[model samples]
Target: MGVRLNGRTAIVTGASRGLGRAIALALAAQGAAVAVAARTERVWNDKLPGTIGDTVADIEAAGGRAVAIRADLTDRDDLPRLVEQARAAFGPVTLLVNNAAFTAPGRPPRPGATRAAAGPPTTAAPRADWPPFVGTPVHAFRRHFEIAVFAAYELMQLVVPDMIDAGGGAIVNISSVASRIPGAGPYRDFSGGVLPGYGGSKAALEHLTESAAYELQRRNIAVNALSPSQAMLTPGLSYYRTDFDDVGSEEDFAEAVVRLALVDPQTVTGRTIGHRQVLDGSFDPFGP
Candidate 1:
C-alpha cells in the first residue's frame, strides 16, 4: 500500500523466518514482487518455524506476488542465480534487503544446555567456554564475512546495473547493535558480549553500506545499514538471549525496513542508523 512498488521486484535474503520473513512480508504488502531467499526449503527443524515456501504461500494468500528462492548465501554460485530468478519471476530488481547473517559463536548457553539445545546446527556454532572470543577460529571469522559482508557486496554489484537501467533503487543492509565497538574499559561484566568475528563483520558491512552509498548516490541508488535500537526477541535472538526485557517488536522493525526501502536516493543515502531512529524522526540519512 505504501511506496507503490507494484512493478518493482525485491530480493530478501534469510527470509525463511524471523526478522527476514517479517521484512519480506512487509515488502510484499507494499506491492513489491518479492523473492524470498534462504536455505530452508522444508521444515528441517520444528524449532525453527517457516520456510521460503511458507513465505511465498503467505504472500500469495494475501494476494501479493512472491517467489521462494532456496539459496545458501555462503555459496558464491547461488548469488547470481538468486538475482536472476527474481528478475525472471518479476522484473529488474529495484530493491534488496540483505537480511541474512551467520550466527556467530558466543552467548552464554542456558544452564545445563547441550549442543543440540543451541538452536539450529547450521546457524550456531557449538557452545564455547566463557570468554568465547579467546582462541576463536579463523573459519568463524571467514564465515561471518562470507555471509554478512562479501555476499552483500556481491549482490549489490549484481543489482546495481538493473537499478541503473531502471533509473533508481534502494538497498537496506540489516546490521546489529553488536557492531558497536566498546569504548575504553572499566567495562562492566556483560554476560552477553558479542564475539569479535560477528561484530567485526557487521562493522565491515556498515563501511560497505557507506562506501556503496557514496558511489551510487549520483546514480540514484540509496544504500544504508539499519539496526534495531534495542534488542528484539525474534526467533533467532530468542534462542540465544533471554535476558532482554524492554525489547522492540518485529512489526516496528519491519516497518522501518520498508521506510528505508522507499527512500529517495538523492535525498537520503549512506545512513548507519537504528529502527527507532527512522520511526522517531531522528535519523538524518543525509547527516554524518
Candidate 2:
C-alpha cells in the first residue's frame, strides 16, 4: 500500500463519465474516498449505460467510499453544496481535480490519430483557436471562458480554505494543449460564442494555477496544470467525432489524472506537467 493518498478524500469535478470517471476510479483504487460530481446524473440502470454510475459502483464494491454529486460548476452557488456532500460522505477533500470543460461549435473536433496523440503523458503542442484574433466574437469567447476558466477558479476558492485547514492538499487543473503552445496548422473557428474564449480561457487558467500554487505552496498544498494532447473523447466530443482522429481516449486521459493525484502534495507544486512525460517517470508526474 502506498502512503500517497491513504485515508484521504478527493473531489473530482465533471466526474460523471469519460476522463473524470476514469480518474475517480483510479483514485478509489488507490484507497482514497472519492466525491464524483457532474451536471448530468448517472442513471444506475440504463439500456445504454454510462461509465459514471459504473465508476461509483466499482468503488463501493471494492470497499472504498464514494459519493455521486450533481453539481453544475458554472453556477457558483452549487459549489458549496458539492463541498458539503463530500465532507458528509467522506471527510475533508485532500485532493481536487478540476476536470470539467466546455467547447464551442465547430472547433475542429480535437486532434490525433488512433488515440496516438493522447499517449503516455508529455506535452501536446498547443493549437490556436482561430479566426485569428480579428474574426473572434465576444460571446463565443465568453462562453468558453465560463467553463474553462471561471469554473476552475471558483471551485478552488470554495474548497482550498478547508484543504489548508487540514494541513495540505493537491489540486490538479485539467488544462489544454491549445493553451500551452500556439497556433499550429490551419486554424478554424469553433461555433458562435464558444471559439476564441475557449483558447484564451485555458491559457488564463494555467496562469491562475501558477498564481494559486505559489500562494498556496507554503501551506503544503500542491496546485498545477495537467493537459492531454488534444481533448479526450468526452461526451462533448460526440458532436465532433470526426475531429478526434485517434489522438486521445477517456481512459488514457483518466490514468494521467490519477497519476497526478497520487503525488505528495508538498512535493509537487507550482508547475504545469503533461501526461506523456510524467506517466513514464523520467520526470516527476506533478512538476514543482
CA-lDDT, candidates in order: 0.83, 0.69
Q: TM-score for each prediction?
A: 0.89, 0.75
Model 1 ranges with Cα > 4 A deviation:
1-3, 104-131
Model 2: lowest-lDDT 10 consecutive positions:
104-113
> Which of the numbered candidates is closest to the native, going by highest TM-score?
1
**Regions of model 2 farther than 4 Å from truth:** 1-3, 42-54, 104-140, 181-195, 243-246, 264-267, 284-288
Tell me the deviation in Å of residue 26 in model 2.
0.8
For candidate 1, write residues 58-145 as lDDT tens digits: 9889888899988878789999999999999998999999999876233212335554654455454433332257676787768889
Error of 2 at 287 (Å): 7.9
Candidate 2 lDDT, 1-288, residue by residue in tens: 234568888898877766777778778777788998875453322221354456688778877768888777667778889888998888777788988776413221122323233222222222334345566677656767777678788878878887888888889998776673446535466442233455577788889998998898888888888877555656444433435555666666666777776566567766677777556666653434
